[model samples]
Target chain A: MKKNHSGVRIGEVTLKWFIALHLSLIVNSLAGVASKMAGKQKFLSFRFCICYGMVLVITFAFALAWQQVLKHMSLTFAFTNKPITIIWGLIWGVLVFHEHVTWKMILGSAVILLGIMVGVSGDSGSDGSSLPPEGGKGDV
Target chain B: MFEGLGRYIAVWIVSVFISSIAQVMLKMEANREHASKLKEYMNPMVVSAYFIFFLSTFLTMYALKYVPLTYSPIIEPMSYIFVPVIGVLLLKEKISRRRLIGMGIMIAGIVIFSM
Candidate 1:
């Protein structure tokens, strides 16, 4: 049980890593957008392939950025913070798909976000938030 | 509900649930020792987990046809609730009070979002 505290303040150690995490999440949610576009196309069709291919591309980019973020931050913090993508997802829905956003939906998302924050707050008792030992292998 | 896209919605939720199971399966497999690094991921458990993930990705694409991107994110968070419950039921893991509250709040959100 160790708290690898370099004493700079936890959670988003640097603005650079914070940007990296948010960027990865933003790009990753676009994979859902591409998948949705793929769904609209006929299966095995060229358009479907193109859209799904875009999903793969976006996911690959996200994976690279995510690795950098994980190298800096903790997985528990990263996972719990992923709901930010929901906001991006909502924006993409309205902008790309012309989907309607109602007050109920906003309220519901708010509650979920609040609940997740509560859960994260409670997760601090253990050393679960720390990264694995430096140079630990099998990163794949 | 969902303008009779119930079947696709069902498929999407099931895929999410299955993928979370795959995560657990991978964790369980990783906890075990393997003769070699290649054998670690090449073994039946890990291979099956990846296969499940692959199939679920396709299922997600299929389900996205009827499920709008807007509602998809709302529903997708359900996996946050799924993983811990699976851990408790299968691995006999204990739950913390905050997580239970979090799940309860998320359930409330889901019900509200659905209605």
Candidate 2:
């Protein structure tokens, strides 16, 4: 039946997004390795090494958490929410690192949020009929 | 010491390869099942990503044996930012004005985040 086919198609798309979320984490890990190695070789300066190392630790933790999240959430929900890390980074910058949070920072966060909203709205509208009626995709 | 550099570079490349495989696996796994189907989660890609995921973790630990972590995360996100650019260029994906604005904001955030 058409309904069954649509259900299968929806499932397929949902799976793709899940893979994308996981791939994002994997790519992030690889980048961490590359940067660390670059710093060790002095291809990047010493100052860069310290900064890069902190990022590696943070991202590693995040990537691990993301793996667990992927086990439970839809890819679309998970990935669209990933950028919220910027908000956390902003908090870390202000609270821990004592960095400034300029108007630009606020503006950037707002724009990113807006874009995510728009994208999510578009996606949901297009796939409205295909998605499961209850529970739908799990939260990220 | 120079030999050590070569060794690290070799390890890094291997890590990249493994990480790429993990990415592909994760992608394939995501495509096959809804997140709600947690009970029925058996896919070759999921298995591969997990295997490589751990391998990358070890490789990362070894890498940290020589390199510092500070610079790693800064550069790490570069791929995430860059891959989309490649998609835009190679796949001919349209970059909407809103998305472009969003990317610009993200770039600025990255600079600030780096600082």
Per-model CA lDDT versus the true structure? 0.71, 0.45
List runs of model 1 lying over 4 Å from the truth.
Answer: A1-12, A125-140, B1-3
User: Judged by DockQ cut-offs, is candidate 2 incorrect, acceptable, medium or high?
Assistant: incorrect
**What RMSD, rounded to one decimal, does every model reach?**
5.4, 12.8
lDDT of 1 at B77: 72
Error of 1 at A136 (Å): 20
Query: Which CAPRI level is candidate 1?
Result: acceptable
Q: List chain B TM-scores, each candidate.
A: 0.90, 0.53
True contacts kept of 2: 0.07
How many clashing pairs per prediction, in order?
Answer: 0, 19
lDDT of 2 by residue, A1-140 (tens): 12353243233345444455555544443444343343444434675565456545645655565666656566445545554433443454455435456665556555544444344333332322211111100011
